[model samples]
Target: MSSSGTPTPWSYAFIRLLFRFVLKIFYGSIVVEGTHNIPKTGRPCIVCANHSNSLTDALLLVTSIPPKDRNMLRLTAKATQFGQRTFTSWLIESAGTVPIKRRKDYVEGSVDNTDIMQHLMEALELGDAICLFPEGMSRYHPTIAPLKTGVARLVSDVLTRNRNNPDFEISVLNCSVTYMHRQHFRSDVLVSFHPPMTFSPKTHPELLAPIDYNNIRLLTTQMHEQISSGTIDSPSWDLVRVAKLAARIYAPLGTRMSLGDHVRVVRAFLEAFKAAEDGPEVDGEHPEEDEKTPAETAELAQLRLDLRTYQDQLARWGIKDDRIRRQPLPRHTILSRIIVRLTWSLCLFSISFPGLMLWVPVFLTTFYAVHNFKKTGPIFDTWDEIAQYKLIYGLMSGLCVWFGSAVVTFPFTVVTFLLVPALMWMTLRWLEDAVSAFRAFSALVRLLLVGKPTLRAMHVRREDLHARVMRLAVETLRLPEDSEAYFARHGGKEKGRVRGPWESGSRYFSIKRRRKRDWNETLRLYDVVDYPKE
Candidate 1:
């Protein structure tokens, strides 16, 4: 046991501390409940959670398990991951992950080996918890996959073999991972822990048998219900799900949609009605194709239409359909992301470099100044957006060549003349960022000084924006006038802006979000409206 006794080890404490740091720093949350329901001192236990995303759910749970029971948490992981040379793979093993080989063709002895059973029992007999995803594989959509009997049978097997520890317990948490933008920044995740499933049998004559499993089935059905409804409100943010629900709520208000905006609308339907396992096939009866409530059927029809439109637009913009569909950056393809990142990170590491490394500074400076110019946002039609990145890369590659020439031919007059200006430009950009950072810090201080007044001013503005946006949306949608009615009630709000502005007394809000690139250039490319020169 690494550290689960009364006196915990420095290593265990360090691990726990490290988990908190990582969760806060890198875009995750531990929104679990009913942790207390799992006994601190009990018989063998198994923990199960829904699988979504690549590794976020398991990693979060692994990091959150109490150290007293840390060693006991014998987690199961994919075999290939264990073979990888990555630090995460090594960490997985060191943290005591059991390798579950993906079996292709099942043979007599090949099915669930004795060694695996031995490992699981050894872990439980020693009073440790085993964690696993019963679904066995991750899914992209937000819904609980079919519950496997592995957990149920595992508990049954453990009890039959041990025969002695009759009170063994098992816990199952139905978790949903909602991504904001799969490939974007500050993505949110949500975790919900349902009540535990204690082993008990309804038919066992021996009054005292394995922890009640009849109780467990009831628990799982209950979990499926909560997750299916999207009602488990954990503190963890569901980035993609949130946006979708927001879009559904806000779309009716005439908010012109973006591709991201469209996805959200489709996502709500997917979450609510997208059945995972196909139900019994319908015969000739063919249940009403439009059986959905009139409003729901209309929404579903609209989502399908919107998705077609969004995809066509992406195609029209020359984005290869395959690429947009396969946007999740692969763990192996990480070098590509890193290269693109370090093309920028050359600047980060340069700040700590002994001297102003020539290549790094110039690259960073031009990149920053160019990006800042997009504060007002550039009108990049899809082609223009694609072209902009390529141009930047060409410039960066050229700059790198120049720096290389200067370094290889030091003291060469011609090289120095060109290198000197580029070097100066880089240095100037760095200086500007440094200055900007300081000014930002000072502005924060001033905001603090004028906190209440500034807050009040912001509140007023937000309220005004909200009111105007509502008025505009209602009018655009051609809804019958009612002073007491709202866009939310008419089902018009879209793209995640709710009447309740994530704060109380919110004064104003903007539908005009200024992301670095105004991908919606189509909307504003024209200087004047149809009624121009009025």
Candidate 2:
């Protein structure tokens, strides 16, 4: 058995490189911000992040560390993940995971975490960066869950043990990972790091004085706030979906907003909503409770109803608000574009038909396995389960294809072994591209043929509601109505000015800009009662 403070083996480093390569190929992009916040080398550090996606969260945290700061990141996983088989156990062990018996895995009060803490303390003392999820388990909700005290306890123990060593210091860093769409393939991720926080045994003796409960609670609260900062803590995916659509409608027509921009707007709106629901805090200048008048409350309820109706209408149309906002062309023009896109897609498919056919079985098996897993997996575990299952199934299927191809070509030459794997990979790549092209073509067809009239009406209603919401934000929220500021904050440039729908060539207006400012400051306008208000 490997000791706790042992240096990372060569095998772990090799596997980490392979993991990074696979993540780069799997995720469309992983944008890292605030890299400077990572503590300098030579001291122990603990990285605490919100846990949402299962294995992907740990994978990203380890991979995002710069090469200079790179070391074995010792991660904690449930004992079940370590597996019972020798081969599986060896694979997980070699990857630098510390297995712990979780509370859920045992009867109440029976689980003991002393060994886990000991292992973590030893690793930290040896200067390894330790990554652990404070939330304990992955969640489906947008906001951070009430954190378990394990992290706080770990920090406490480490600080207590190293107090006599003058040169030893420990820092805890907050990392927040936001996914564009967690369950969707090829979606983007933003990993934001906050400045490291240090707790000294000298400053707060209670941290080390017999495992003080009050001190631990305070520390845990601080960690929770830091981790939750700048993250989208939505109540549910449905509200997120609504917020996204509303944001698209709230923007100037024809603007092609990037996914990051969309998420920013959604997050801003959620924040605003939270502030509104909380009312004003008790300051000397404000009332203890800034109670809303009955009339105002009624008006707000009506507005929410309208928004929900709009969301349902969007669902029925089979199109997203952003798609409508981006492609504001006439019916005839949209039809023409669909035809052109379909023709291009058909041409590519024809060219890739041979490769597609060869890879079809592998793709089908992988897809079916992922779909069934999603259907049967626990709701909160959906993303993690799908990601792990897909990766394993894909590798297994690839090997099967390679071996089959090699056998068929074996009579020709020994070179078939290498050639077959390369060919199989190429075929899979072509099939993936072909499928993407087909999906795009199909979406365009749906918009033009099935959703034409509904989309036209939705566009008008979206514009009107957007104007009303902006008015509410300005008058009620006391937010500014600065178009330039909104565009600047959203990372978009204003093209021209807003124009009336009746204006000439309005059907295909420049998605670039609008002249008139609809409303100004962004607001979080989603419902509060459905999901925990925060």
Candidate 3:
């Protein structure tokens, strides 16, 4: 590693490749959008993002960038992490992570971070992209926290130092990382990059002086808003879960909505509810003596209660809304359905048996270690637990599989060492595939027999409630009947095409071509607000 916090070319390339491979294996799918917003090559830019997942957040952001734009990327982490363990410090150092003492550390009489600050400034001066999580620390929060002023200070320092250099420019780019099922293996992740917020020296030469308190606050708030724009900032995870299910049910049947689209629609519904709650009255007249009528208040309350109830029922039944939505009641007779399920179960069992035998020990050991570790430690947040479990389990089990197999087969021949490790690796891959197959089989059994009637009833009730809510939204909000008209007015249109904020380059991730219709269908389904016609 170079002394100035920038990685040597070879080390950078190696670490980048390693991270890509590891992320690919850990996450079932990773979707990235708005890559076009990142300049292929340009002046140093600060990439700011929300912090939730521990080390995984940094890894995802770094890997998501295109290789051409990724080479110059440098990341920062809390200094305490480097001090805790030799392995961690070495790993982060190898990846070119700069360590800075946090405010708490300063209070504890830790050495000043002037050297670290110099390292960062030097890296930026060399035109390297740097990523920082403005939240200062990771937690299991559903929304972004109050941002620290470190980012603002760094930007100010860099820009002020280079004020006389017209050719040098600094920009702050907003990125958001949304996990579909965080803490679960094989979960999906969506990484989105938004357009850069440029701060040109020529345009604002007065910023050459040291940044003041007000300017730092203003800059931090602006960056926070930009980063938070792409994320669904909910009050609670339960609310988010309920909102997603409601969005899915309200969405037209047979339409395939991407997880990102599902999240966007959920956020919109939450926003609408918030707006209604804050509004003085539903209409000009109040049904009650107060601003809120009894009926209107009751309906809103019931809506929330029903959503929570539905979520509880789904959890109790150990089934998800998607499974019910995708695999609706089969048109076959009971006997035929039974036979089909049995056949599928047998097929899955046959494929998964060998891998299960080989990998069961590793899986069980990792699971036990994670749970026990959590119990012994200071309360671990969700993402922290996930990061710890994944890192420990992945390293420990991987080593066991590679070396244990070699030791066991040593008597056979020298070639047995290489062959055994290869075989073990292949078995691990097969185990992942088997786990997916088994989950599908389990879901099918639940849908077809275990809770079929209950699912059907819930689906019916969900549809009814959705319809009632839509009607309520229309009446209370005075929404337009035709969604296209609403879209045309609120969303900018060109050549008969309407673009909502979700489609903005700096707002949200875009869906694939095949799923584009699904997103549009969802928008149409919930486009209840009325805006004045142009």
lDDT of 1 by residue, 1-534 (tens): 212322333543454465554443223122333355554534456767666544555556666565443443556877667868865565567666788765643334455556886788766656666777776665444345666556655666655655554453444444333333221212233344455555533323232344466744654566555444433222222323322332333343234333332333434434333321123234534465523455554543444344444434433333222222222334445444444544443553356253345446545654564465446443221211222232234345545656666777877958675755555444534433333233323333333443445445544543443343334334433333442233225332222334554521231122122111111111111211011011
lDDT of 1: 0.43
Cα misplacement distance, residue 314 of candidate 2 (Å):
2.0
**Predictions: Cα RMSD each:** 16.6, 7.9, 9.5
lDDT-superior candidate, 1 or 3: 3
For each candidate, the alpha-carbon lDDT, in order, equals 0.43, 0.64, 0.63
> lDDT rank, highest first?
2, 3, 1
Q: Which portions of model 1 show Cα errors greater than 4 Å?
A: 1-13, 28-43, 65-72, 83-86, 104-112, 139-147, 162-168, 182-185, 201-300, 303-534
Give the Cα-based TM-score of candidate 2 against the true structure. 0.78
**Superior candidate under TM-score, 1 versus 2:** 2
- Candidate 3: list runs displaced more than 4 Å: 1-8, 83-85, 105-107, 210-212, 252-254, 274-301, 322-335, 377-385, 403-459, 469-534
Tens-place lDDT per residue, model 2, 1-534, is 122344667877776786676565455456677788886555678899998887778878878888566456778778877867654355567787888787777765688878778988887887777888989887666768899988888888888897776556678888888876554444467788889887666765677848759888999999898877757776555455555544545554334333345456666656555544455455556564455555665665556567778777655644445555543667787778777777766775676676665567666877898888778766665745566555556656766776777678768546877876555545544444454455556656667766557666777877777777777656665444653356545543222223456542442232211221211111111111122222
* Model 3 Cα lDDT, one tens digit per residue, 318-389: 555555544366636434655665565466457657645656766687777777766764532544556546
Off by over 4 Å in 2: 1-6, 86-89, 203-206, 251-262, 274-304, 326-328, 371-377, 381-383, 402-456, 469-534
As a TM-score, model 1 comes out at: 0.47
